[model samples]
Target: MSAGANWAGSHTYSAPAFVEPTSVDELQQIVASTDHVRALGSRHSFNDLADTPGTLIGTSKLPHSVEVIDEDTIAVAPWMKYGEIASALKPLGLALHNLASLPHISVAGAIATGTHGSGDRNSNLANAVAGLTFITADGSIRELQPVDDEFDGAVVSIGALGVLTSVSLDVEPAFEVRQDLWEGLSWDALLANLDTVTAAAYSVSVFTTWVGESAGTVWLKQTVPGRVRGELFDATRAAVDLHPLPEIDASPTTQQRGVPGLWSDRLPHFRMEFTPSNGEEIQTEYLVPRVNAVAALTAVRSLADRIEPLLLISELRTMQADSLWLSGAYDTDCLNIHFTWKRMPAEVAAILPTIEELLLPLGARPHWGKWFAAGHASLKPLYPRFDDFRALALEWDPTGKFRNEYLARTLDLS
Candidate 1:
């Protein structure tokens, strides 16, 4: 048996047998013979969802295939990395509607935890899923579609229901995106202009240090017609290159053809490529009602006096509501606020409660896979269909074979 740790190095567990199953049949055999079984991806989760006391099955060896079913759709394996999928789709003139900061997260892992990116007009990664294929506890491979009542509950199952093997996603023709970076705007200016700024681009994000005034790195992504040819866009690109948000270094690499590969390969919150100070760093992200974004950001900025020096970076982003159960975007437009602290877990732990207290009034929902103080009780109100999802989980894994301490505590699964 082998033990593995997650990205944050916060959780680890022992498995009597650690198996890498390259095929579905092998996975089924392992699960059928083991008392407790859990499927693991890239081990990117900060939480303990992937930890199991029995057999740990790593799906990294699973085959990843992308097939163009139609001009607007594609079928992909759950093991596929976001960047690999993007590269495959690019030649076909297709693209995902939204992508998490990093492209390295596995399809199943991202969908399991409801990962997302910034854009008031965009939705969670699971929202793009039109169908899913999984091996249920009974060893039957079932396919689900949007029309099924279980659709909403199954998309973001948190790896509790069963092992998801593949997914069918809705896609669009490939489009050219121009990323622009700038800074030097006040919190108020950003809040006031967020809607406009996001609308001007396909996606947008503001990166600032939690302390002091806003630093000069606001990243913007705008869809352009074909290849962008102009000095204006070039100048904006230059500005971004010159004064990158504090932590993100925009350098080319051989692995990703020179584009910032970090964004597509690391944990969602740790996706930025720029290397900041090498102190201990911890992260917490909150998603609140879109309408309250400006107000909520203002509230955090007001507490900047207490937050700034201890912080490394604060990111502001947005996404549309999604139907996936347990999704932060469940039934509400979301404004994401992320904070990175300078290697002081104790100080971060101390101030987090205060930050949550300030944003809770705005209906903040913590990211399931990130650090937060909220438990199942706090999760209920945020996810209206919480009970329904629990019921679905019970139906899928009645024997409690996939149950773990993290799943039990977070989902209140018996």
Candidate 2:
């Protein structure tokens, strides 16, 4: 396959070459001989994080096996999509704690970016990782458990340290979920009771155009045998299936209307077989501490007139705190503010600094895989252990074999 644009068509990887190694042994050989290389997962990232100055190694040609480690966990190929992995686990009566908004993203890619699904109690996807195995810059395969001192930094490496090969994630007994859609919660009511609204479901997402005075859509994914249904604060359950983007057709969305189904089928908004979101949008997201969610929203709403014109829609979700060094939710529970903007690069770039300035003081961190104007200097202060992560990256790849424009700019790499 040609090295094409990313899933959002926002970033066309600029690597000199794109190759798919047939096996782990071959993958290692490629890494050992290349001066600089980067692993290309499902190409779901909206930014240039996946691009490399040298060769781009596609993981699809490597092993796609799913090895059952134990009753509580399983090891999966880094290239496998969450939807593909979930299919293998479901038949065996196992399930992951959460999936991202779309399941088409690869296991390694999602974990590297700290991607997440919605839920006040749910942590981002990387938190589910119990162990990781990767090919270091020196061509040595290294295994790391969550207990390792450097494990936290390794989990969300952003392809700075090495090329991840396999990831083991904690799993639970299979469970079912029922997704329901609700609409029209006034902007005031949403900001006032954001926590209560999120806690209403196993996972929930509130979407809006901001041009309107109220939330345009609210999706509630409730685990089977739960009661988070019906009217909620004047937001009534949608009588039919709906897409997060109101203009888009709902057929691509996962089954809804409170019909209970396997977790694999309901947790994600888009069905595995369908393209997610608009497929023509660029994304930007910031995760702020829960304590400042309301204030942050209020601050951003002041820019609604400015934002809505260039925006497609915005989503609000929650994530529990995690210990991963580069994770947006590193030290605090976060409320995610994501914009799926119309593919207008210059316009989005011009507006980002203002958003960052308003939210950064509120303890916001930009999502690693999305578009953001913040460079390493501004981002360094957000993560307390950033210097340590930088030290770790340099220690593993002292020659900077994996370093690229994205890492150089984001990590301030020499």
Candidate 3:
């Protein structure tokens, strides 16, 4: 009973059992009966974050429901995809603070892995969680709110605590956004005014291949009612829709050319109806502290020739500071340097250590859901609350019912 391969087919699940229980009772029963279990969400992870040897309990079969708790919050089933939740909120005149590059990922999976969208003012997606409910290893349902002492550690549990069932997220009045594109900005200008370029819009993504003299493209998602104009560090505004990868078709991307649309439609880089990014590619990301961003980018730029060969595209985005224990933007604002690479796992894996060697020294933290070379010893010092998070996981799941190989290797929970 194989759990099949991930979205990119980069890794296959070794779990011997895959189960999707339609009801909460069924899910609890399965969780309590199984000695080792892991809740699997949309297979968007580039690594083995969701794998286990005993049972891979999927949340997709669970009911999808959204309850408006108040004007600023909503409690939704964990199985709901960000896109589905966005569609539900749009009609009610509500919207989440931000969304990932693609909305096809499950809400629980995204929160657990500390996924995020780009914005100088917005924190990572996990920060939006106001409350959470999960089935503990003993099959007891537990709920935690922002007031809970362990809430911060539990928000980004990495599926090592329990099987999440409901997630309450902060919401706000719906708004319209317009996406604008800029191209051919020299790296000299970008690195010189990096702060100004990222702060030019509500949300921005700067794309590059690291081999070129000019930055590839800049996608600006700005709140509507006003357009972003004037000096953009001498970068020329694009007249047409464009994809991050210069050679790929732009039809799959969200509305560009400064077209204003609903926040749900413009916040994400891709439309829900179309597949996001290169389906066959792998991804890796590292969050560098705002202070070290320029130095880190310079380090990677130094290895342009090595990275250019296996790269499909690379993006740099910003995130505001957060208090969540394991979040990449925990204490300081961060600049996310992301890579969408050609599916050469062996080649890509071989080159990662070189990149990590350069970036890690400058206080870079790897994205939890993406491909990374650092393990427990290398990762421990990067997070201030790393040991505390392990303690909380142990307290919640005493028998290690939810632990998996990925968690063991990354957190040294074994």
Candidate 4:
């Protein structure tokens, strides 16, 4: 059987066998017998990160189980989506520290790729992971905890190590959040007060098209009490709910206009019940140290004429430092620049090199699951633990049973 295309239809899997094992014993048998194999999750990746020429194991059919190990930690099925986990925790008065834009993404896929949400004080989703249970190359069960020496290196292994069966995440008391939107702030004021603007809320998102004087919309999700009035550095508070893309409808978005709601409901941009879009776009993202956020934005703005035409929209978000070796925010606070482009793959691919030439010099790290042209030579210097990570992958799977074409091309791991 053939594995289908990804969520955005941008990349199709070429694997000849797609199997969904319903039990851990079956999954282990398949992995042990297959010479080359990989695990597939929610299919949210835009590239070939989860594809292999051999058997592709679909994880969704695995048993859905949740266990509250203690008051502060919860262990869940690796294939469960974030939305499902959040809903399960709410009634018990617990919640994860943050959530990515789409709750529909599977937990194992998101953390393995270093995926994150927005907030100056919030660490990436992988940071919430306290422990992991993996089905390794030999089909033997292995568990890694925070106390392990190689735990940090394994957290974001990009599926080169093994298949994850369970993920233990740290949780906190559930809280309420309110979302507010502001618009029409010029680039001048924004650049000047950028620090103050991002620090104004619990979570912040800045949207733009790179074609106008106005820096575009600022969406804030706050946990503090009371209403926010007046202007945010010359940008006026919006009177109604608005989509990130100005011309599009906001009906599919989460509750806005400063309405108080559960953190699980307001943290994610899109409503869990709705499909955010028709999967008509391609995405690219780069995370740079927060100190260079201003310089990086200025560099991209210089090529606005080139990027504006092929773009659907763009967003800027912030994340706190993390210890995970391969995480974009590793060791320092980061500012991530995201682009949602028109489905013209050729045009988008052609312009990426030019864009990377400018941003890569300013200390930018490309998001693992998104489309990026930078390879091992350009990326090796950005991460301090790059060589260590490669060694870890080799140690975990010496024969390369879990390694695929993407891993070979990007990380040069055999």
Candidate 5:
């Protein structure tokens, strides 16, 4: 019944019993036998959300099935990787709307934490769910549809309500995407032209460091119809070209080449072919209202003097509004601000409070899977449906079988 013997490098709760179920029946059996259980996927979460002292269920081995339910819908197991799903759906001429930073993260895990990508017109991955099936704490499998009131709450349940077994996603026709990577933009110019630059493409992300008031690289992914026939932006033709490759020691030619895959398939913002700078890294991401993005980035920019030497990368991304109750984009467009620290856990911890201080007025919501010193009190105000989600958690999992320290502390689920 048990698989993982130790906790997998989470911020807290280092040791826990982990289990991997091969089938839905086996998963049901485990849930029936274990009073405390939580699903684990890819172990990509920086926080202890997936960590449970009693039993951590690993869905990585769950049966992989992708069924084309209809022209607009596809059903898949929760354990499916975004890459796998994209590959399966490509032939059907369909793909997910957006993806997280990494495609390696499982489908359910990404949806559970409201993982998002860059695009003012696109929402988090969870928003694409037309329906989901979950094994309740009492070992009952229930299917949820968008029409149900609990649907919004369930999409971003964070594995508190139940163990998600399968998901039915609303898909769009597959399209080609051309990436235009640009560098050597001053912070002032980027901020001034942020709207125009972002609107220039379907998805836009700017990566920089807290070191100087300039962007290190800007990646723009523009969706094109019918095989993306022409070049979107020529790095060679840019007036102020500064390649992202040399900064990360990657081949510029390779970095600029467009890969044939779904947008979700290439979720990892960084190119795998490149060797990133070596250092002990810690990540912290927060979502602020879209209107506040400029102000928030400006505030964070002011902290360059304090955050640069100890920081590695800072990314700015956008997300459209979504109905998922706990989604970062709930009710309004969102701008994600991410920080990657270079070693110095203590220093990173120290700067986080200030980061929160600057973002609080902007109504920033911390990424559920990432490290944050803030607890329930601060988070309650950030997410309007925080207590509503807890109520649903109680109703769906009254036995508290899926409850964990993180869930109890952040979601106030007991």
Candidate 6:
């Protein structure tokens, strides 16, 4: 781990080397020649999800382009960051339905891991992907659209299926958004009117310090023509712009004060120009069915003493369900309960099991890119289509060329 670790420096890859293929043909050749390889995204992952014991084919080098094929769709290169795609879409007066909290992650990487943004009505990032073009294990190019039977299993592949080359996403006419921050929400009040709080804005996030019965802040990103409810049960609008993470500068955050701006500008919490979060933190998130969100939060907050010491902050966001097989929100609405902990890996690891013990029983599934102790054996039943997804993985990567230790340990793969 001394070299080639993840962004948080939490997990070092076992990759013997790295490759940067600038074209589709080159990516295909690299995969076809290698017996075991994995596609490396922006290295934003906190765990060994992207690590491999073989060569790592870095997708950041495989060319770059964005195509607005029609008013409803746009195709983007795998390496293009979400911010870049949003910038490209802005000029065309187009946008996607949602975006993750940070705009720095690559489109392909985020989609592969089921990354999502906050919105009671929004789906995870992969939901916008209408078509995909990937180089299969055998160097064969396969293009799949939403209509195809295989499309659902491929969206949240977790870099398992193959090296994704390009993705076609559904887009819409550009719209405006406004951000407003509120402070001091009693935990009891929020849990009681959870529905009301979530519906307060187009995209809402509740941040907690895990110290008191009160959550520290609630961020509301409202769409144009959308209502701005700055005052919740016991919370008031922030007089000044605020950062979700306490004691940090808010300049890196997207504009606040409910100033209406482009969707690309306000959907994500952090601006693309600056780094998101502290970059010194390790994240762990769980997606539980929305029905159990309150109970799940209660369970984690019950262990506040253990979390506060190693915690930077915690965020709660909602996402509408989709049919994507591997999606944490599949067939049921979800609450993305995220924790950004201090760089204390050992302590964090020790505390996760207790947290999992509570939430897993509530149907919590860990975020693929974050640090989690749960393995396939414990997590399989959560996804009704887990075995189906496994079958699809084996079908596409017959020789296990795309299999890595993370998948082996988490998917029960040999």
TM-score of 5: 0.90
- Root-mean-square deviation of each candidate, in angstroms? 4.3, 1.1, 0.9, 1.1, 3.6, 1.3
State model 6's lDDT. Answer: 0.89
What is the per-residue lDDT of model 1 for residues 109-192, given as tens digits with 9 covering 90 to 100?
989888888777789898989899988877778899999989989998888888887799999866555555555655555655
lDDT of 2 by residue, 97-151 (tens): 9988888989999998999998988999999999999899999999999889999
Per-model lDDT: 0.73, 0.90, 0.92, 0.91, 0.75, 0.89
lDDT (tens digit, per residue) of candidate 5 on 1-414: 444322223254443577677889999998878888888876667777877768888777789999988988999998887768877887778878877655667889888999988888988888889999998988988999999978999999888878888899998887767666666567777778777666656777777885564566777676764233233222222333233323554342223444444464344554334333232467789999988888998888878889887777777888998878899889989889988766577888898999899997798899988778788888898888888998898888888888888887887776
Q: What is candidate 4's lDDT per residue for 199-299, written digit by digit as tens?
A: 88888999999878999999989984744545698889999888777677898899999889999899999988988754799999999999899999999
Runs of candidate 5 with Cα error greater than 4 angstroms are 1-15, 225-246, 251-280
- Superposed by TM-score, candidate 3 places the C-alpha of residue 403 at a distance from the truth, in angstroms, of 0.7
Ranking by lDDT: 3, 4, 2, 6, 5, 1
Candidate number that wins on TM-score, 2 or 5: 2
Error of 3 at 112 (Å): 0.4
TM-scores of the models, in the order given: 0.87, 0.98, 0.99, 0.98, 0.90, 0.98
Candidate that scores best on lDDT: 3
**RMSD versus native structure for model 2:** 1.1
Error in Å for residue 247 of model 2: 2.3
Clashes of each: 12, 0, 0, 0, 0, 0
